[model samples]
Target: MIEKINLNNILFLDIETVPEEENFLSLDDDMKQLWEQKTQYQRCDEFTPEDFYDRAGIWAEFGKIVCISVGYFVNKGDIRNFRVTSFFGEEKKILKDFSNLLENHFNQAQHVLCGHNAKEFDIPFIARRMIINQIAIPNKLNLFGKKPWEIPHLDTLELWKFGDYKHFTSLKLLTKILGIPSPKGDIDGSQVAHVYYVEKDIDRIVIYCEKDVIAVAQIFLRLRREELLIEDEIIHV
Candidate 1:
């Protein structure tokens, strides 16, 4: 059996993504034709090398991080003190700085990295962007060769399965089920891109990302507490 891990080593993180640029909407003839055929939201109108630069611009304008919020909870014998940090600005620098901080300050003592849907989204996204910028990924996050189950990851969404993959659960729904107040506020995921693109408000994106991190953390805590009571009534009666 795998040994139980100390939660302190785990860093829970989430990121907010937006289209690279406004001008990316002006695509080449073939791409424009493809975009024109798709429905409004379904269109990939903002994808291009130029759009990547636009994303870089937003990253610079916001502080280099496109809104990455990480929550670290270390158990201090009796209680856990959760420290949350929001990273914004240039993707490369912010990622490098955070990687260094994690290695020098956090990685040495931790047992594992944890997040909600992190394996599918957050981790790879950060790793790929780091590669794009030629920044080395922290050793703690270098999981390219690791086996899925063998990897030291604790995804609350995966834990919800409890080894039985029957139903799909979202963070919001899980939080609601556990009686944990949803931190989403008035902004949903669909609105995130628009808020970043139209409003150009980095603060809003930061707040939104922080809320998601908190929600994921809460879900983890609730699961640990065995507070995830299945609503059998909703399914059986």
Candidate 2:
């Protein structure tokens, strides 16, 4: 079934996010209380809400997307190329630009969205943020009322699970085990918030995000028993 789907019809992507505010103290009194309540179970007397604030980016209500990087396949005859691009800047603009890309170019019923663990994280995060910013959700990301088989989304992490519901794998670990090149640089997801807030290095984050997109596409290729993408085949546009 995986080989039946045309690679060109899929848009592979990854996103980077950071907390809405730089620190706990920056939140208003009401939000502060809300944050505490939100994490009460997870914190469990081991750490205060402030200590757990760095992970706020994991939740749409308390964080904002900083970058969304996407890559799609372009196959012509014997040649195959993957074109990659990114949308970053103000959260609203990022969501708007990404939404437009989906609505305009990838709006076909056959078009699908692919990401690592995206079914649980990336897809919902984008939809939630778009709603918060009052942007209409793109057809590709809008899963409302769609039957399970009718949904046009694929998750590499879920694929790797292979019916093992308890199994979990990180992109980095999966890539290593599958022999795909590692995407990690000097920074990782844990450091993205600090890079965006303190170092003010969005460019670095964009590069990281793009790398993840490429890695995802490569992972799909591997899953289909195809060759991994050579560096020369990856184009950053």
- The superposed Cα distance between candidate 2 and the true structure at residue 212, in angstroms, equals 0.7
Clash-forming residue pairs, model 1: 9-110, 63-89, 63-90, 64-89, 64-90, 65-88, 65-89, 65-90
Give all TM-scores, in the order shown.
0.74, 0.99
Tens digit of per-residue lDDT, candidate 1, span 1-237: 112555566777788765444445555666445434432343256554443333332232211237788876655675446667887866666688778767786666345667777766677777777776788888777887977765656777778877766756888888888898777876876566667668877788787888777778777767667332222211110
Best by lDDT: 2
Compared with the true structure, the alpha-carbon lDDT of candidate 2 equals 0.95
| Alpha-carbon deviation at 31 in model 2, angstroms | 0.7
For model 2, residues 164-235, the per-residue Cα lDDT tens digits are 989999999999999999998889999999999999999999999999999999899999999999989988
The global C-alpha lDDT for each of the candidates, from Candidate 1 onward, is 0.64, 0.95
Candidate 1: residue 182 Cα off by (Å)? 0.4
For model 2, how many clashes? 0
Number of clashes in every candidate structure? 8, 0
